[model samples]
Target: MAPWLQLLLLLGLLPGAAPAPNEPRAAGAQAWELASPELLEPARFALEMYNRGRAARTRAALRVVRGRVRRAGRGSLYSLKATLVEPPCNDPTVCQLPVSKKTLLCSFEVLNELGKHMLLRRDCGPVDTKITDDKSETFSSFLPLLNKDPLSQDFSVKMASIFKDFVTTYNRTYDTKEARWRMSVFANNMVRAQKIQALDRGTARYGVTKFSDLTEEEFRTIYLNPLLKEEPGKKMRLAQSIPDLPPPEWDWRSKGAVTKVKDQGMCGSCWAFSVTGNVEGQWFLKRGALLSLSEQELLDCDKVDKACLGGLPSSAYSAIRTLGGLETEDDYSYRGHLQTCSFSAVKAKVYINDSVELSQNEQKLAAWLAKKGPISVAINAFGMQFYRHGISHPLRPLCSPWLIDHAVLLVGYGNRSATPFWAIKNSWGTDWGEEGYYYLHRGSGACGVNIMASSAVVD
Candidate 1:
């Protein structure tokens, strides 16, 4: 046996070596509970590597397993597991395979919830692997196939196990219960099914501004610095009229529209880029406008910091609002390539928007606003990294959306079958789902955090 394998077996004897055995037994036991010998060795090796140097590793040595069984497919599922090994020490004399004394079988899964995709793992919490949408459940596994897109349908043994567990547990815990994961699942699906209230394929068109044209230094000055400056109106305040109550019970799994934003590749403008997205919807909700604003404005103009990229939304919001507001994409175009924030990029403000308090229940709030228009909300940004997909549950503390550096907009709300949900707009280009949106439980704060009433915008 490989010395590394021996070390792993020896490490398994440690009292706390593996995840707690009492962890609810992966939700569903009978349906997809079978384990593979093939999975054990590879998974063990990957865990050792992660334990030894998770901070130093480059590529995630793990793979996400997702797929459908096709003709014989039962309910689909998504699973996570470890694969491959990238050791820093290639020379046997200078380095040996990292031992597994402190590693847990599901360590990688913990990292998944932590919001790091490059890291590998074997499984997620019983409820974590379940996707938030129903149509999305068709592709039940998370295993990224060798040649297939991560979003496409395909499966592997380890990944298959993930789906099987999800379905069985969901069936038992939710389906069996009067109301359980069912409500959350339906909420997510409803968001996935929504038609974009404003832009549809028939009317959608390409206009000015993009992330590719600006330099990283430029992106920061124009976009980030203004929000970060110790200036008036830059900081977001808590909702004054928000009622003090227990957190709202919500299921984000119902139907609405969802879409993936095109990857910006390796840019540090995730903060600016995400904020612009929410603001775009805000502008739309307020003025009935559909302008795709310039991310490069922050990339180039507000130079309190580096412009090429790297700044906070607090700064960006401050700069935009104080300068009387930003412009339409057509008025001040972006090059996609980044630069320092420049004076030239500060376009004239089309409108001045304010924030509102939530005095009513989320359902009541939704019903009330349903008649007016869409409202934007803020939620905590877990980490600096931009979220594309695969997240099913809350992995971080629930803070006011206004507090988190990242931002997204709340569009509409509805009941999926009978479960209630809030529809949210996403910036990850449209290929992400039925459209560029996702659903959250009506009060999950999963979409618009710290939501109450949107500060009404009069066009």
Candidate 2:
């Protein structure tokens, strides 16, 4: 009599309109109508395959919108439409979803035979389909994007979902217009990250990280140091001494020659951090007292290197000598910006006699690092932006070694399942990589890890 009642009757949601999920079926090889409860098993089997193909965060489940099971030669063929629903949160442990949301619609063809089921087809589209469900799981993931690529017709919707997850993870807030623009940028970044992941030769994973939504230009402007090459700066005196054969493994942190990880914020002051890290280790080994040195003092006092725009570790090392020494980080707290040089002689606690460059040979570099504290180095950092963890060994063509744009510290070296690696100390904070560390592949000169290898001499 009522329009709502008519709609429910048409969808087979009425009390006696369809067989209940727990209802017993007739004992004969016959076709199960759309309302038959026996078809739910094949529908669930199809959904499991669908969800398993998606990423953990984006995996979803569904309720049967419409379905039928037809008796065939050996098994029943199930053609089903289900309404997809997202998980309450993107928890990897959670595959459950509230079907009341009525998110997307998916058509799945499953062949159930001999106690096993095979998925024949799956085509999901964004639509709200009325469905009834005893249980449902999460829906939507990057798998569709993987199969479809970035140019898929439904890519806009998929990127929007991923961007929303990124924003939530990073606690980012943007206006409507800016959010839309960022979504576009995030989509493009996903494409780039996919390329990086595909071409990467090492075990390093490239995907949605802290800067997943950032454009390449913005990422470079904020985190990269472009001045390493622009101002070649002074050449350091070459170290004449080479240590004995390096041990199987070495770590300066375990030896207490390294300080806790420090964040450089949004400034291009990695040159200062790299030089200071090397000097800190040198001072600790030579003076027997490890100290966290000031990078802010370098940012302010280094006359040869540009303050925040970019600088070279070699220039920072030279500037430290000319400025009398470096004050402790406590005395010259980091403000992450250019400031008038207020380096007081009274606060200068550590001094460098001079800085010397290390040998370029990988074996020699390892020996030098093992005996003489951590070594300062520069790298191309092309894949560093997307690096999460594991050994990052990008192909030379992907990450050019000549275009060194960032500075870091080499604290140790070791082999993992026969893959030699250099334990690098990055200034991007503890959250960036493996606790502010980047493991680059060794022996192959990956990303110029051996380039710009130098250390301050503490007398």
Candidate 3:
């Protein structure tokens, strides 16, 4: 065995032998009743949850050997022993291998209540069945990426398993060359994510996201705006002080000031979405009617700022005022690309009086947001590519305030178990981080939350 393989085995990181990190810990068996209909349902529930968390290709068929159930408060606890059998073949055209026949004996405990089944604990050990060395004709071309292991510490085995999971989660299908390159990129990104996770001061979890397969440059060019880092030319007028202090926490979404989370698509139009979200909230609080404003209108009409390429909210506010107010999202729907000026003054629904820059102090920014509305701001977006959830507070050097890239909206501020965070709305749709929102560390000006803060002044 290789030295690295020996080390992995010593660390107990062998493939297929180790339970998933989020799975329940292994425990000894307890006395229980015999197999029953109630117990079978809970066992099936546990199996379903397990399968859902795994890659579609790795899914196994369940054959119950024994089962038992006991009553718990408002739910039932179940114990089950079963065999997990691997599928016969991956492709119908090439069926050279004889079912792979490999299997495992797993002991599972599940809790079921009101149609919700939760797997409590599972302990699985390899069965006597084993796979032959034969490879299918259809699968041989991508053999390096599809190798299976019942229990081994080989790097190839682990890499194959993880890469498969990532592709399945994102529903990605790539040719051989693309798949090889993406696997390399995925490996590199996971390392970066681990570093970010270790350096984070807050409770953020960083790992394989939807963007795991993409290289840093690809992610930046497609999703981030380079123009945000540029200076806004001249400084805008400073915001005035509010009459009352803000509460400890605030969220514009609950108050109906913010619109539904929208996607910016593949364009670098995060700047436009950020500005629109801020203005949307501003218009709602002032006019008492929530309206989804047009981001495409700004993309087409904002002469001072570039469309799809990148733009600044300060210049975008001026553009909104230049276009004789702004039109609704329905009037000028978004196409996620640069287009000719099709904006109409007669279709205008909401207008802004002017815009103001906020103080760099987070306390004051929160105060202004509480009184005004969501604030449009730019962030470094350094660790944002693979950011999953929790209060993301990367190290200052990693996510510097001076060099910002992506634009976002500050919709709310609150605490996550004593770690304060700013709920930021991104333009990447609800399927992304925290339901289209990024919770950044607050109070310390993490990720340039205090830098480049500004908003439209709706009448």
Candidate 4:
């Protein structure tokens, strides 16, 4: 026999030799195996690094670890019983892996060193393990990092999958599906914008934004004042009158038996709501009745343009006065609508000593609301979507905090012996805060008083 035939015969006769040349490959060929034994340690390390670097001061630690990962090239370069991704992203790299329970993913990223600055791009692949999905339904979580693609294919598909999972988790965590969906959309857009910025060497501009994003001053200059100039009928103002008594003292206006209304979401009608709330309270004080009134009228009809979605109480009061006084909550109703402003017989309810701060006004207001029902009060500095709930102040020195803007009704006040604090209601809805209410120091006058317009719910 020929030498080649002799060698082939010997190989075929060995224990694992196949009977035929066309035989299928065995399970051993396609079987899944650990990508690397080192995955566990590297993953943990990356997570720790991410947490440490979450703040500005610890960013240097991240840079140092980034350097280490750079040395771990993607190859059969195994060491100490673990497979680690090799760096110099001529291939994929991973960092900042999430803590989850459902799917196990190994992350990789590549960075382009630009002297003192570095551009980071990342990719991740599923590891086929039973783990938690941390990305599920979280509106603000699972944001994809910027992509610096040296290759033609985009990582957008994977990014989107992660985003979807984030939304899923967020929806599960947050009871409000609509709010979660909207936040998801906002987060995704923000991520995309960040990616664009990274791609352009960390410098790019976002185009125009939604009208709601504009500031009160910006809105006035761009829209409100102009509209008022062209359509004078839209501009409403209360005629100045001689005061029966001095303007009510801050303490008097601030004092009230604590109650809160849920914060309505950003609809650019805060002016209307604030003014309406004040009106509602004053009306009740004057006529001894309670009725919800029309906030929608200000939202729809107050076309003065200064503050649509972002309005002020002064403007809403002007609109009411311009339209020859607002009717009782029972007459026009407090539905959120925008009906045509019509002339009404109702006259503005006035509070005597509007600015006078009677002694122990806080105690008086508390007693009044405890006996009556709810009293309205004005707050300042509420300028975010989160205010739609009972938001804890990010800062402290709880002595005198004024994070609330606009005005809200104070229905009742109470305190537990264990927790010597007053409970207050908000208008942002019931799911917010400690069951649609916030607790503050009893005598601090943070929210216990303020002349929210009173109401008269006449038939």
| Candidate 2 clashes between residue pairs 3 or more apart in a chain or in different chains | 59-138, 59-139, 60-138, 60-139, 61-137, 61-138
Writing each residue's lDDT as its tens digit, candidate 2 over 1-459 gives 777556545543232343333333222212223465776677766555555534444445554458877864334678887776644453435435333323666777776643455565565655742333312222243334334343865766676677778877888765433454456667777776776676677788877777776656457766788777666667878897675888899999999999988999877789889999999999999989999999999988887776666788778888888989999999999987677789998889999889888888989998888888899999988867767888888767556677788999899999888888999999988878887889999999898777788888888
lDDT, candidate 1, 133-160, per-residue tens:
3332333323333123233233244334
For candidate 2, which ten residues in a row score worst on lDDT?
A: 23-32
Reference-based TM-score of each model: 0.41, 0.67, 0.67, 0.38
Supply the TM-score for candidate 2: 0.67
Tens digits of per-residue lDDT, candidate 4, 358-451, equal 2224565555444333444444322222222222221121111333334444444544443323344445455544455544434445432332
- Order the numbered candidates by lDDT, best leading: 3, 2, 1, 4
Best of the two (1, 3) by lDDT:
3
Cα error, residue 104 of model 3, in Å, equals 44
Backbone clash numbers for all candidates listed: 103, 6, 0, 84
**lDDT values for all models:** 0.38, 0.74, 0.74, 0.36
